[model samples]
Target chain A: MHFGPHLLLAALEGLVTSAVLALTALGLSLVFGVMRVVNVAHGEFFMLGAVLAWAITTAIGGHPALGFLAALVIAPLIVGAIALVAERLVLRRLNYNPEATIVATIGMLYIIQQLALTIYGPEARPVEPPFSYRILLPWFGYSGYKLSVIATSALLLIATWLVLTRTKIGLIMRATQYDSETAQAFGIPVGRVYGGVFALGAMLAAIAAALIVPISQAHYLMGQDPLLLSFIVVIIGGLGSLRGTVVAAVLIGLSDGIISMFFSPTLAKIIATLLVAMVLVFRPQGLFGTASR
Target chain B: MTDKNGFFDLSKSTLTRRTALKGLAAGAGLGLAPGFVRYSQAQSSAPIKIGFQSHRTGIGAAYGRWYEKTTAAAVKAINAAGGINGRQVEVIIEDDGTDPGRGAEVVGKFATQHKTDIVFGTLFSHVVIGSAPAAGENKMPYFVVSEGHHVASTKLNRYVFQPGITDVKSQIESMAPWIAANAGKKVTQIFPDFAFGYDHRDYLPPALKAQGADVIAQIAIPPTESSFTKFFPQIPAETEVIYHVMVGPAVLTFVKELGEFYGPNRPQLFGFIDSLEATDINSPGLEFLDGSHFWEGSPRYAQADDSVAQKAYRTAVGIDDNGAAVGDPKDVSTAAHMFGCWETLYVVKKAMEDAGYKGPEDRAKLVEATEALTEFAEGPEHPQGPKTFNGKIHQCFGIQNISKVEGGKLKVVHKTKIEDGLYEAEGDYTTQAL
Candidate 1:
């Protein structure tokens, strides 16, 4: 309960939040970067991942670790498939028009949310962590699984960075992002790249939800907060900049935790929002975002 | 004829328009015409429509589901036993989406579109507060089951009533004596930062102080907060009891984090059952609450000395001994508070009958009738317990159950008397104009 330990605990908690926010925001950033269309249903995809995790784990009915591992692998894949179908049926049909796709994705959000509510019911159900180790500090004990989430997120971020920088698929996506018409002219299959990027973005969100479900119970309405936070990260980190998204997520998460410790939580939120507003006024391009061409 | 669903079959009514006209003609010819009496008789056959404002899709949806079920069961019972004023009771539901703006709009729809005689069955305090002005503007009697002190504080208009459940102010006040005597003297409170939390934050200290105990620390967490370990350090080192009352989906995480923070050497934990309503007590990460105590508006787990009415009420509501749905153990009922929905419906029926309520025109009479009632005895209709109604403030005073978490189930350890929660009236709703 001392100042040092309190600050340390706040920072640790903030790291876990930042890790999830980074992954979720990265998904949104990628879709915008390549497709130039906002996916409003991104949060619902995250919710779907968590709900599917619950169903898969319950169906498996074995060791908690086995079920959790199964969820980690399967939930994202299922969510990604669903996202692909949405792109084909809705987004592709809209010709990926920015305004039309925004509306279409909003429709998808409701459909996914209502479907989850109907199938999963209105309860906030918790999933047993893969492991239940408590890291007892001299000051307080912490969930070992939470720390694992941070590490897992970091590894995933690195893998994603490696793919974007080094792989042919990443090269195709980036060329399409830079100029879809030019990429198409060069036989890059711009449409296919868009579809793959959309699916991958959703998959990232799903993965984050799966990781956080043990720490926070999966409820039908749980997507709202994450969606809002991810949007903040996406906007403040500079849209379409993965690096900026990760950095902004960490900055916002840590500040939120530290500020809340000093002031009332409501006041903390006001201060955070004011800070975001100031950033917007001073640097419209965001902290790392370049000026638009 | 009445249908099996307890609604009247209007097609099978014996009194046709022709027959009514003939009766009126005959009465006029006999110089015994009583058109008003005949009109009243015809109107009495129509069903009483009660509009239910539900939280079907938002944060309060879990509680809303059980509230809907309890309301249905209560309505079915009331109709089966000859409903209010010999008319069938019909419920029309409108989801409020658990948003204050949506709540007010729903109340307006209930008044103008549904044309319901009364709007009832709202649970969340914010929703109730937001909807009350619309009810007052429309002059539709609004009977909410929300346990918020807003109704008792007389801050809302005269149309709003909280006759179904005791408000949070009374519930919090009642816990002080029992907590100070049994739990601990130096208490630290942890609650969500909102109107609901403010009720406890503002009321508990004075009540505890009166009982020779003091609240050492009060930590208010943001409503959106999911992680709580960072805030755990705010509890004073000399704290003896942690009185936590949190609501919403992240409650499981909060408890889990609290457990990890304290490990095995934590202080005594006393929390309002609102924190875990509709949640399984034996859930993973809740091992820390094994011996903690909670305040239950109604006992979730059936006690050995449960009254006959309580047993019958549980059966009627389809809740088992463990307070889960009869067949689904995992689908836990919000047994602590959902009983208010049932009890409130019965109160509505009683008031309607007392007022001879036949249509919306008699809404004022119905409100007056409800306010005139003073007490409800423990029976099939009033299953939670006997309660004293403060008609002036439009809130109920009821005994509260203090239950301990033992053997992975909440066992009733103490029941506070109604007087323990009674406080001087803040204001009188009767003083306001209808």
Candidate 2:
């Protein structure tokens, strides 16, 4: 293989990683930005989506595409509903106190993980890709499913952007994020906004999970790595900044893919950790974060 | 120190009638109910407790689930056979979460809290390595079913023994020549970057060299890596064969990504059964692997020449001919590595009976008796075929299976002799203080 094809392959692979990472991190950013509470269980929501996708697809036996489409719609709604319940019961009771909510979400994480273990069993189950077309590149053939995943994730990210920017719910969320007490004083229901934002954040993660389940089998312990990586992206990209989350996710995911390919995965992780350390030492507010008064 | 009262001390052991009943029920479910009533009648004698360190929560959860099943099945069989030395054997399980620090803590809990006579049943190599020191400190006989060469290499304590499973060094030594001759001479290895994968990385190069083969490129992937397309371009163009041995929950992804990377036009593929341990071959995306080969510790699919003992064991474990659950086709059995757990429990029974093991006081005697074990023939006790145990290294030498993918099933193509995998004893566990 020549240098050009090899680089193109790596770039394409990196882009796919970036796509998934972007969506996942965007959810984390949205939750933190709107609710002012870190969702430690965000990855569990992601895992729940994938596992539900597997369950849904397996139960409704027929064309793979039909199963996937059903899962694509149903899994996120279910996950979002669960998140809404969690927000009302746990986060709302805690008054969304940053430290308390972190601990609460950690508890939620183990509960969700154990529940998954009980219902899904420990076995990793794969979902059949809806299609099996291979797009022929100049150097090699690529998985059309993977390319579709990249495209789908991008469209989802745009929709998320539109929701946060163009909709009335988006305005209410921004107002509550700006000042919850004042928003409540202005007749905006802050609690409802918080609940909606939490559900939307979880829904975004679920959608990403639904997209990637065909490629990555769903397992109980699959949530931890994505959680860690998303935290890294949120930290580097500036927590609560959706635009910064996207930029940072693309940077981290692409570098991880390219570096892991050329050298070793260990090296890629080391570089990522080093980058995180540098960001912490020099730019505590993160690249796109504004310093609070 | 026992209180001189007529009543026995309950603090020393948690073997209440409730636990005994639970064990009996578990045994019955696991196909070992023949002597449960008899054992319960003689339950006045304290049951021998074995601490089972299970990987119930992490990346090893899939294997851990099967290992627990096999352990239960073996324990049921042991109890049904009138128990070890006529005492009902109870397994006290503790989940290590497949984390190293937690593994040691679980071992400590087994020694101090559970008061188990011996600690056993850890599958992942790193967990074994982490927990072995706790076992050594407690002077508990640790019998692991893990395939890492650490025990045999003298890196672990004398208390740690792998008397039922062949280590990676021996396995690779046995399979290298066959892979070279049948697969290709120019190999490229893709293995997880950990102690288990390092075993393959370290042993296969020299073993392949001995077979007049050479590895052109070696790729070390993180065990947690879910996506693998990025690493495929690194394989040298002239690579004749791709040897992959990946673990964790992402094995299907690893394989699917590999198929995506290579498509129809690919090099010869020879992978360890680790890559597909719990995966169904007939699953959709795996059609690309229809003609590939895999090295299995035990063939996943039951072969035509399977012994009656193998079939009986499968029935007891509820695994069907296709290596899936009897009724649930989607649930796959990790047939390759899980057999070691079943065989190891039997080995424990044999050694315990040989030493007339009565309690924790007799644990040292049991270890020595286990080291004295020589060859195990194919029977209900050893369904994974014949094995010769090396007392010095505390690892067993067993026949290795080379199975080909035919008609969406793994068919045994070659079986290496026991001697083919044996190497010079690295260190004598006997030389170390018991």
Clashes of each: 0, 0
Alpha-carbon shift of residue A171 in model 1 (angstroms): 1.3
Most accurate candidate by DockQ: 2
Model 1 sits at a Cα RMSD from the real structure of 9.0
Task: Give the docking tier of candidate 1.
Answer: acceptable
Tell me how candidate 2 scores on lDDT: 0.89
In order of the candidates, what TM-score does chain B achieve?
A: 0.90, 0.90
Minimum summed lDDT over a 10-residue window in model 1 chain B is located at B32-41
Error of 1 at B132 (Å): 1.1
Task: Please write out the lDDT profile of model 2 over residues B1-434, one tens digit for every residue.
Answer: 24453234668876889999999999777775555544464434778899999988888888888998888988998899898888888999999989989999999999998889888889889899999999999989999989999998988888999988899999999999999999999999999988999999999999999999999999998787888888888889899999999998888888887788788888999999999888898877888898999999988898999999999999998899999988998889899999998899889988988998877878899889999999888899999999999887889989999999999999999999998998988777798887
lDDT of 1 at B29: 76
